[model samples]
Target: MSHRALEVLIVTGPLGAGKTTAVNRLLKAEVAAGRRVAVLINEFGAVSVDGALVDAERPELAGVENLVNGCVCCSLRDDVVATLKAWCDQPEGQRPERVVLETTGLADPTDLVDLEQEPELAGRLRLAGLLTVVSCLGPVDHLRTRPLLRRQVALASLLHLSKGDVDPSAAVAWEGDLRSAFRHIPLVLTRNGVAPTDSPDPWRGDLRPVPEGWEATAGPSFAAARSFTTAWDHPVDPAALEALLLAPPAHGELLRAKGVCAFAGWAARNDGSDRWAFQLADGRLEISPLPLRADGSAPSCAAVVIGTELDAAHWKRALRALEVPPAGARRKVTVRP
Candidate 1:
């Protein structure tokens, strides 16, 4: 029997980092190379928007599993293992050549390493590498405040930093700080969602919220930054949506925002298929044409925005300016940062 151990790679990053884009580009390239690959997406949100974006792009995957509504590092560890077991149980002809597990931005990368220590998985799967992405556009305090960032950096086989070209000087400082914080992780700056040695294709866009009338969850040191996720049923205007992202009210309070939005009418591209993916960060806005969807796939319209002094009222008014579909404004739920 010519049996091969399944290689498992873990990808982790902060909330706004470009992990999705990097993973997406890598998947496309691997598939193009005629490799059977599977992806396990762990999203920390009530709605699984990240999984949706990934599902649309690569339908021919060996298998795709999404563990949502909790971080896989803690609450969903069993679920993740179950997914791996199911994949391993597949017939030899059906098993994939490689398996990639993309963890929630808030996940502890070390936890995944711990999972590989399990006796059951040792024979079937091998932990290949760890890829940690860092977005330069996020507030500095946010990075410093995150609890597990140091561990993530220390464990990363490859450290990828994105959007550094936006500010060369800041990138230098960020790299220095990262080196000072972590032991000895090889760091690489990513261009257009990939490293210099890699050729590319491009790009894409969780968390539960705290609940209403409850004391606000104590946040990290990022008092100047906040993030919110929205899922709307109605269509949005592309131009209006762009303007809102590019020039949000309150004088540059918007730091970075990304989402999969739907639009109607003649200009609207949601002809029962196709998605409009929008990204805004570090004073830049981009609109990319997403692929037409697989059969019976529903339209995905969601957005996550990070900004200074951003609150529900502000976000609500901002989307309203673009006449966006209502994104469930009745609750005041937030996740512990």
Candidate 2:
């Protein structure tokens, strides 16, 4: 039996390093160049937001799949393999030119490299390259304590230095540190998630081989972190939502938080728009209005907060406060947390 070959690229990095942003940029470039591409987004939280963001931003590109609630490098490895096999089984004309898998920030992508060597997928799937996005704004201490971060850098074919525009002075020092530590890997300084034209294209190269006897280093268990999602059916107040993300629960340090919220009277606008997206990563908060869904339906108002040792009760109560009717409102609305 024979199978059509599929190029696979893995995008990975630490939490808030902008892996999805890089993937989005690549997808736009590929689509503009008339190349058919597929994207597999693995998110740590149950309520996924990255997939929606990609869909809104890259509506022209099809084949976007979301794997949420688990890490693909471990518990969901089998599912990941199955998804790849299914893609390979597709008819030749319908197949994508390339497939990009954006792993959760906590994942160690070394395990997925073995997919090329899988008995069922040997000829069908090819491991093209691994691109790791590193945030220049992250504290230097993370290099010492976060073994997963080290593993991401050590196993990458290319390193993307993200968020350098946030702090140019600090980025200079960070780049110096990274060059001293991992000088072998090719590095690209990117701004606004845009990679240079000369950046290597994984699809154009020969497939890379899986490393033999690969082992992951010990790090804080991803299971030790917890996530809480609050979903509401009706529209929410925009200011209340922004305030919530601005000062997340004090009990735990927020690693990442993102949401697609349905709002009414958002930003004092009367344009009749209903949805907005907000993301909090590495202590920066970004909130922007979402493009209206093509289907003419509003997405549920929801937010997922991920962190270490969060106080669930307090967080839930804080979220419920968004339910109360502000002064001059006709009626109090019901909220679910």
Candidate 3:
């Protein structure tokens, strides 16, 4: 009897760059083909909004794990290795055929490439390749300010140019810059948040060793990024919440914001569901209703924002204002000292 290395793929991108969307599309297709696939999402926040988003989209998936409150590239690196080892130890019949790891925007993908050689994971897990998702619609200035984005691009085996449908001309211009900057890396344009099927799948092939001198210079450490998280049991006013996400207290430096929260009496046109999901990236906002859980219960309600110089007190105060009051109760206002 021979052992088969667990196939693994790494997906990296900047905040609001559509990493979750790309991963969801891939997982959806893999499961539809009857392949046993799992996704591990690393979010730089206390609550795992990305993980909950995955659950909403692919309720049937059983291996969606989230590593939150830390970046696996640094703080939680050991935990990631342990998880892979545990997966490898599972019985053959219960093990997944493929695993996709989605890294946080603040994560340095370069640090994680060493996972393939970990003693415990050496033979059990195989590194496929790195896929970096770049949002064509986002402000290019982020590239200059966020060095992690450059490192992600430099380490990628495949560059996924997302949001092409939003602005074709912008997408073309972004592609030109990417081609000139990352000329050696292969790139693909994605429309409607879906990666192309005929293209070289980011996680399907043998690992391609990054050439010498491909590593980008180090920039600000992960410590430069700060995250704020809020959770409320009560449903909120959707309009007020949307406004808050669109314009953070410190709007200029706020990079990414996303979460699943309870919306008062909200339901999709096709389905009567109460839970809703919202995402704000690079000033673009998206809000949609989540599917009902299999058990017919509401999902967790929480939101998180990651950026530089975030005012935690202001965020807390603003979120508190959006909470919907109970039928006979008055809204409570807290004055922070």
Which tens-of-lDDT digit does each residue in 1-337 have in candidate 2? 5555788889989888888788888898788988778998898877778887887784465477888888998778888888877778777767776899999887876677778888778888877888889998788778768877877787788888988888988778778877898887778889989878897764443324445554555554466667778775555666786787778567877788888876655452353456778888877878777765667555566778788878876676666566534566643344344
Candidate 3 Cα lDDT to native: 0.80
Better of 1 and 2 by TM-score: 2
lDDT of each: 0.67, 0.76, 0.80
- Mind giving the per-residue lDDT tens digits that candidate 1 earns over 203-239? 1111112123332234431333456777655667777
Q: Name every residue pair that clashes in candidate 3.
A: none
The collision pairs in model 2 are none
Colliding pairs, model 1: 44-207, 45-207, 209-333, 209-334, 209-335, 210-333, 210-334, 210-335
The candidate maximizing lDDT is 3
Q: Where is model 1 more than 4 Å wrong at Cα?
A: 139-145, 198-230, 237-258, 264-266, 269-274, 279-286, 296-298, 303-337
**What TM-score does candidate 2 reach?**
0.88
Worst 10 residues of 3 by lDDT: 205-214
